[model samples]
Target: MFKKVPILIFFFLIFFVSFEDLYSKDEYFLTLRNEKVNLRQGPSFDYPVKILYKKKFLPVLIQDSSDNFRKIRDHENNSGWVHISQLSKKKAAIVIEEELILFGKSTIFSNPVALLKQGRLVKINKCKIEWCKVKTGKYKGWVSKNGLWGLL
Candidate 1:
């Protein structure tokens, strides 16, 4: 049993470290997995439902976590808790500024591909510096990162 003691201790340490990394309060963004998700006032099912979000792919900031629940804040600054299963790691963002120009290239001098209105949800391809490559419906282009909500 003496030799088994160290092995068990090593496994425990690994599990603890993995758990912490998985749920760390690093302020990352996650999108809604389902078309409808309930935002609770607290971290459990016993808590009241504060909001019923019907929009899928809506990005929310993961502020904190409790058990299987995540504390999130939406673009409107509404904060609440949601179950982890309702969240997705898929990169997405909502246009926060009205009439955002989607440029063919990352620069403003590039040709305007399309105009995106506020509340438009776009799948984030990638982001560099002050611009992000996004796709919304049939259009895909770069937009100013300042006009979006969901990036660090």
Candidate 2:
């Protein structure tokens, strides 16, 4: 029985570590799953609707969770509870800077593709060390990661 003690402790440690990882807040970012989602005052549908979000793919920061709902904060600093089904793991970001220049290449010296104003939302294709490839409407280019929100 003494030999089995070490094995039991190893399994317990693994299970505890996995549980911590599953519940860590760690700046979880998610996007709107549908074009229309209601931000409620509480975690349940019985609560009053605080806001009606109309933009799909809008990035939100997950702050807390209760049952099937998650408390999220938008780029505008608006906070409310939303159903988990209305959120998606798909990566997206909002331009936080006043005027962010989208470059043809990741390097700043590259030709400018477009100028993105603050509050502009774009889908993230991929990210490098200091830049991210993004797409918004007809514009597709690389922007510095510093100018974006919703990234860890």
Candidate 3:
């Protein structure tokens, strides 16, 4: 019994420390996992649905959490509660500029493939100094980093 005490304490400390790092310190970026999720006024299903998020991989700021529910703020500054299960750790970004040109490569000389309007959501695959490789469905290209949000 005495020999088991130190072993148990060691395991408990390891578990606690790792669990502490599992959640965000204050605010962190999370993405919508499903194509559609319901945002409610409160942390429980008893609350009425306040909005419907139909965009998958949309970046959202997690401001608070209670149990399995998390309070999130969208790019439009809308606040609501969503179930944590509907959220993913994948990072994404929203186009903040009124209009942004999606380039074929990460340079101004690259051919423009599409024009992304503001509020458009794209998964951030990687980023460089002033450009980010983004994708939404079949649209994959680079966009100026200055026009995006949800990155550090």
Better of 1 and 3 by TM-score: 1
Q: Against the unseen true structure, what C-alpha lDDT does each candidate score? A: 0.96, 0.96, 0.92
Model 3: per-residue Cα lDDT over 34-71, one tens digit each: 99999999999999999999988888899998999999
Q: After best superposition, candidate 3 residue 59: deviation in angstroms?
A: 1.3
Ranking by TM-score: 2, 1, 3
Model 1: lDDT equals 0.96
Model 3, residue 102: C-alpha shift (Å): 1.2
Deviation of model 3 at 21, angstroms: 14
In model 3, where is the ten-residue run with the lowest total lDDT? 17-26
The segments of candidate 1 whose C-alpha lies over 4 angstroms from its true place after superposition are 1-25
Supply the TM-score for candidate 3: 0.76
Candidate 2 local lDDT, 1-152, one digit each (tens): 99999999999999999988877765689999999999999999999999999999999999988899999999999999999999999999999999999999999999999999999999999999999999999999999999999898
What are the root-mean-square deviations of the candidates from the true structure over C-alphas?
4.8, 2.9, 4.8
Global CA lDDT computed for model 3: 0.92
Tens-place lDDT per residue, model 1, 1-152, is 99999999999999999999876847899999999999999999999999999999899999998999999999999999999999999999999998899999999999999999999999999999999999999999999999999989
RMSD of 1: 4.8
In model 2, which range of ten residues has the least summed lDDT? 19-28
